[model samples]
Target: MKQETFGRFEVGSCSRSTELQEERELIQNPNLNPGSSSLSSVVNECKKRRPINFCQEEEEERSLKKRRIVQDTTIPEWLVNVMMREEINGYDPKLILAKKLYKSDIDKVQSRLSLPSNQVVTSDFLSEEESRVIYEQSVLKNRTEGLSVVLVDPLLKKHVVDLRKWKMGGNWNYVFVDGWNQVVSTNTFKVGNVYHVWSFRSGGGKLCFALVPPRNSSDSGHGGSSSGLSSR
Candidate 1:
């Protein structure tokens, strides 16, 4: 009985040692199949992802927006078709932002559409001189003015509007003030409706935007796939 017990203990010890040795070999051997062992596969995957995760975390920390802005390239064909007009015929439209209307957007009192800086996807729509003006105004303690731009609705009606960088409390936001009420009333836009805003240059190099509504009433806003536009 004693001999049999000792024999079992010795076998168990040898099995454990063999496993440890195999683990070391697997780590050292670069030629081994990645899927051969589950443990090694997990380790390899983690090693590959470590740098990517670290970079993303670092970028998020540095940006006040907390999220990276990626340009939306896959615009819908129907939207492109509608934007084909004499004024902006040759210019290719780039998506600037997509958002669902908030209560303040449709409110008569607010009389503006607020575009949060954090939620903005592509901000390169502004020219160097335009960006400089916004930066200069942002630093001022009082009496900041807005830049006038032409905003075209779905029906190709132009609304001359003032785009301003308004700081509310602690957060900074971009707003289409002044003539925004006209846009809301003319289009009959309501809260919770999703719209896509595209930027382009006119023949005379004037900065312009085209606002595209969701493809259908049932379409989900906020740039969802259901709205016929991919989410960033």
Candidate 2:
């Protein structure tokens, strides 16, 4: 019986060692998340996120409106159809899809500053396919010149935001913005911090926009915007 017990202990030790090794491999794997240096913080962020207030703009400085909230906590599970190198569109991965960020899923939102690639990117925090679909429905089908995205807080119940069409020079990457110059002036963005951005169209006005902070930013005492913080 003692020998059997010892054998069981040996098996358990091997199992734990294997599990630890697998986790280490996952943490080191770049494809799991090309931007993150380590996975411990990310895994914890995935396990839990802090809350953010949508209505009140977090900062008085308009320049620092929205950039860099919490650490990059976006999960691999949030991605769809993990593509190998062979399945990409261009030399860069093409048509990579991320799960939509609802008002609640702010933690999963990735920073524009953290994006590793720029092909088929959008002005809003949307994938290329997503922005394209909205464009088709709002502009092409309606026969309008163009319709932009506007973001509003559900609590505020306000309408109408200025929308602009920005070109990516010779390239095809662009995101819609209400305050591009203002965001540029505020150099308050960190590369690892995550931010949530969304747009709304209401009462037949131009595209309006809104921003959300990471769930963890509330009590972390970080020097950043609680209302609108993002690394753009």
Q: Where does the lowest 10-residue lDDT sum fall in candidate 2?
A: 76-85
Tens digit of lDDT per residue, candidate 2, span 1-232? 1112232132112234444654776877746663454555544443332223222344544435333221222322111111111221111111222223332222223212111224222334444655565466444555332334433222212223223223334443333334333442333434344444433322332334433344444432232322331223
- Name the best candidate (by lDDT): 1
Query: Which residue pairs collide in model 1, if any?
Result: none
User: Total clashing residue pairs per candidate?
Assistant: 0, 23
* lDDT, candidate 1, 77-155, per-residue tens: 5456544545455365678788788898889799988888887777788989877666666656344576778787654
Ten contiguous residues minimizing lDDT sum, candidate 1: 223-232
Cα lDDT of all candidates, in order? 0.64, 0.33
User: Model 2, which residues run further than 4 Å from truth?
Assistant: 1-171, 184-187, 219-232
TM-score of each: 0.58, 0.27
Question: Cα RMSD (Å) per model?
Answer: 13.9, 21.7
